[model samples]
Target: MLPRSWVAGARRPGPTPPAARRSRLYAHLFLWVMQSWLAMFYIGAGYAKLTQKHDLLALMMTWPAQVDTELLRVIGGIETALALFIVAPLMSWSLFRSVMLVGAAGLLADAGGMVVFHTLNGDIFLAAVNCVLLLMSLIILLGRWEWRDHAQLRNATS
Candidate 1:
């Protein structure tokens, strides 16, 4: 039989094992870095879209001219909101953890749409950027997912 002290940490959580603690620390660091990078990227892009006129923006990218002014602004607002929401968990209480998932999912959808829109507009660089954002979004989404005890929670709550 296994030693009494060697039981799963989840069941007996007086203190996490050293290795588990280190691993959890590393995971949190990784997520924080990625979240910061993504939030900055979206914030900058959204700010540019929101502040600059289409004529000025068109000089930077071809699509701004074709897309409606209101539509572009709306996209910009959504991007900014998504970026804020993604980092909300870090700033808020544990009850807000689910906000990260919602934000990541929304960013993923936004990136997916950008990929299609950029590809159709023949902007290869923007499409590639969209792909990178999509990958990052996926990484954050999967990394933060509460895989452990998710099934148990559903049954326990109900």
Candidate 2:
């Protein structure tokens, strides 16, 4: 509280400009909205895969009938885990930031797999949905990537 030397070098931050503030707000809103949507989607889909009888699941989506039951359940587990971690209250920790990227990447992979599977099975609607999920995953990954830090690291290394 009484460190004059430290205080002398520190500059106070001025009020944020309106454009900057609005952009920041929009970014936060986008993240929250996307996270909520993805979490809900994954949770519902995962829960259905985990708990529903194969016949019942197949009635809703034909892909489940073609996929092995064990494999389907494994995919459901992965989806549920990714959903949970994507919205986990760990963003404040720097280490958890990387986890978000991993979760996003996992979602991207899952969606890509689904897209291919659905497309091959002639499930156009489901394939389109998976395509949307893939886009969302890409957006989340881009939004979370630390461009400045990595760029600075590369420059420093060079």
Candidate 3:
């Protein structure tokens, strides 16, 4: 296994020369890809909710007693807004960060509800997928914020 020192040292900031900018660009491209994927997921989810299909309505019915159908629709609308914010160039970093944090929280709550639903219904696969998706969204949100902060710091120092 790799030494702990190596792992810790890997987190340290390094000199970013000219070529490093290209690497950063590539990293942003990768982030954009993930963002796009997340956006697509939200778009699909919003569409599903808007349609009020039988299956989706039934699934929403299974939501905890504390959460009402109107709340669920609002949540879906918020998700759709978040998905747009993440991909829209016109959105400021602060706005993006705010939306991302809110989105992450919503996703976590949604995942929790999914877990409860699946547990009650004995559908482990869907629960697992929801958990994984929630985790991934959290990771991406944090990573994007860190990347944005790092860039800001580098700009200030340079």
lDDT of each: 0.90, 0.85, 0.68
Candidate 3: segments with Cα more than 4 A from true spot: 1-15, 55-72, 89-97, 147-158
Pairs clashing within candidate 2: none
TM-score of each: 0.86, 0.86, 0.60
Candidate 1 vs candidate 3: the TM-score winner is 1
For model 1, the stretches where C-alpha displacement exceeds 4 angstroms are: 1-15, 154-158
Worst 10 residues of 2 by lDDT: 88-97
- The lDDT of model 2 is 0.85
Ranking of predictions according to lDDT? 1, 2, 3
Residue 126 alpha-carbon offset, candidate 1, angstroms: 1.0
Residues 1-158, model 1: lDDT tens digits: 99876876656448778999999999988988998999999999999999889899988888888989998899999999999888998777486678878989999999999999999889899999999999999999999997877878988799
For residues 29-51, what per-residue lDDT tens digits would candidate 2 score against the true structure?
A: 79768877988899899988898
Worst 10 residues of 1 by lDDT: 4-13
Could you give me the TM-score of model 1 versus the true structure?
A: 0.86
